[model samples]
Target: MDPGANWWEALSAIGTVLAVLVSVAVAIREVARARAAESALEDERRQRLAEQRRGIAALVTAWAESQYEPSPDGTHYVRRVIAHVANESTEPAFNLNVVLAYGSPLIQLGPLSIPVPIHVLPARQARSWDVSPGFAAHSTGVGQVPTDPIASISFEDSRGVAWTRGYDGKLQEGGGHQAISPDSETGEAQIGPLDSPFNPIAVVTAFHSALESATTVQDLKPLLSPTATGWSALTNEELVALRDEHAAYGLAAHVWYPTPRIAYVRLIHDDDIERARKGDSARALVVTLVFLVGKGWRVFSSGGAVTEPDWIKFPRKDLLRDLRG
Candidate 1:
């Protein structure tokens, strides 16, 4: 073959390879552009979904407020913390729960968590629930500083999707579990009185009725522990007098269980402890009932007089310390 003919053929082959390379480069660019578009569309879809989820959860909101006010029973003034929940949307919120908590690094008498369940909250309305029962009234000896509490709320939207708004007020889906009624002092879970004999109020009521008929020290001894100071101090004559007094007064008892095993009771004529705070002219009987493992409930400590408003101690330091653990 001639040299020029060979050179022309070589040049044609190089042009063919260049054309193929260009075609491949164009294809790769087009594929990359398509993938980029798909990725962007996916990101936008996710963003929309997130916004929709947040909108559904944000319909309801909750906050906490604390104030010094009359207790629920109208006995005395207490520093009370209440949770306020509002459904701002036109639709009703279901399974609404408000929780006021002191999270982590427990403060004095803290690591406190109070949960109140409101089965349903009506549309465009608000509701309030007591998170703490007269903080000063219940927590008598506990340090009262750092009383500010954070609140979290959980509720179900109209679509039956569960959501939680945390302390930061950020909305998230799928709350772990609902909090039912909780103990006031210990924040332990308790269903209402189930008619069991172990119910604290029932046991105290029965004990009160039994004490009213006791005629002698021997009769009273069974009602109170031998180690109780009140038991040691009561004379036979005093016991008879007390029985007669109980018969005449028929005092009502307000019981608080600091722990399952311990009860602090306020024996009052009515809900009014104000009468008792007035220099013993009319005073309330403050007693402690301890549940002995096999023996049931007995008056562990008695004859404590609440002659002053500050003197009424329900959740004492020792009990709170025990609760902290």
Candidate 2:
């Protein structure tokens, strides 16, 4: 063997090793770029959410402009109503319109409407007009929208979304609200306290429903309680793991309302980490299994054994008090 030939072979091997090192460096760079891109995306989402919440807040006030006297047991009933709008927001509310929807046989109305020209309600301002040909009446309690009213109030937000109060006393968003006994009243629809469209129980159920049928966990983001921490809003890694695991075993869950103030949720199936470590998905596990009704129904805490859900021992409280005798 010539020494020169050996030198050429050695040079060729070194070149090959250098090429391999370059390829490795490029691969590592690409991975870092991908991670940075994901981090930026997550940051953008959080920023958008924060900005949206900071936009504006508006709701119809529930101050009783009542006309009814006390009950036999001396319970002051709210029969008359003054449907009004209040802006408890920093952002001025514009393009406001309140529509009244009613039904016949069960109720009666042609639908009354009130519009604000140059429509704007300054922060801490309110619109209180005698909206009572007859709004709904609560036999008892504060400014209560009637469940069995001849007509119901539907209104629009500056965001171009129409909403009505739900049975759970939260606003439900659609385009319009359907009055009780939808005979001729069918425009937009939402729930009310008499028939809540998305109660704490329902909101929790919808969250699980999204997990059961959604491609992205972000769909469950809106349902998460504002106070939720840790895994409630999963980080990128947790989300990926869940997506991978859930693909293997179709996830199913249900939210049960033990009380208006509390909700209990349980996962029927999921690839829980404990089970995965044990090489089994047979045992059921918790996926945000408990919810308490805060301002809205939100995930209080999650993760418990399906066999013995220690959290189920708690009691539920009534969020709304019906003083109707």
Candidate 3:
């Protein structure tokens, strides 16, 4: 064979070997890339889980600090959290279940025999969640919304007392009334009382009566003497705004009265110092007062009314005489 031919053959073999080496190198690089991607995905998953645990821990701490205790079954507790969601959402956007679970430390949702699984779904906005009923034998008292825009949701037990979950995963009485009736002029209808020691139904009745006689703010002023603090605290601008708002709605108070028998008052009682410091301490007596002019019944005031007479200074002993007809 010619020496040039032999040299060409040797070069061809070397070229083939180089091509094989290059292919193997390319395969190894691809494998390494795939492994790296898998590792990154795992790291991300672990990070998400850690964040979730941290969130759960924070919620539990808040509940515990509020003095909430786990249920006898060791899995359930009641606490109040802001139900953050649009009024029209189909599902709750809060993760109350996880919060409850972590906060209660050992409470289980199953033994509670709730009909639906309490779920808190993520809201459209960050840092908010929707609350609602979850899987259990009965409704969890989380998702129900009131029909009226001004009305708030409340829960009632078989004994007719209203109930609500506190921030610490414990059940407590709610501040609002379950029902209100406004139409009866005789003040015999059932309604929740306002927060003051004064009866809400009575205030409403008096206000309604005074409003019927009032042609201006001056006329309305005397009727509101029972809730003088509420009125006095209002700025002139605020009163003007209120008047304008009422005028736009063609609203005016005529006669207001509370149902003497059905109105009940609730007092707040909790030993949690943090809750009180957080302004969570609240006592309310519910009374339904009907306003004749509005042809509606309102849950008078969640906060009770206080009497502040401008010119009269009567001792507590003579107060009854002064108010007596």
TM-score of each: 0.40, 0.35, 0.28
Per-residue CA lDDT of candidate 3, range 31-118, in tens? Answer: 9999999999999998886554333322221121112334444556533122221212222223222222211122211111111122
Off by over 4 Å in 1: 1-21, 55-59, 69-81, 89-94, 101-125, 130-150, 156-163, 166-174, 178-325
Q: lDDT of each structure?
A: 0.56, 0.45, 0.32
* Least well predicted 10-residue stretch by lDDT in candidate 2: 132-141
lDDT per residue (tens digit) for residues 1-325 in model 2:
8999999999999999999999999999999999999999999998886456434432442232336655444556434444456777655555554434332323232222133231667767876655332232112135744343332334455565555553234555553533223222431222223223233334444554566555554666676644445445576666656545444442222222233234444443544534533434454434443333333445555444331334343223422332232
Local accuracy of candidate 1 as per-residue lDDT tens digits, 1-325: 6999899999999999999999999999999999999999999999997777667568898877777765455666646566577888877888776655452431122212222356778889986655453222233243645445666777888778889987778888889343422224443312113243334444555556777776666665666644455567678788776666554332332344443445555565543434543323354565566545445456665554422323323333322322112
The alpha-carbon RMSD values of the candidates against the true structure, listed in the order shown, are 16.9, 25.9, 18.1
Please report how far candidate 3 places residue 213 from its true position, in Å.
Answer: 3.6
Among these predictions, the greatest TM-score belongs to 1
Score candidate 3 by lDDT.
Answer: 0.32
Query: After superposition, which runs of candidate 2 have C-alpha atoms over 4 Å from their true positions?
Result: 1-40, 43-51, 54-65, 69-80, 99-113, 116-118, 133-168, 176-182, 185-325
Instruction: lDDT for model 1, please.
Output: 0.56
List where candidate 3 sits over 4 angstroms from the true fold. Answer: 1-209, 215-223, 226-245, 249-325
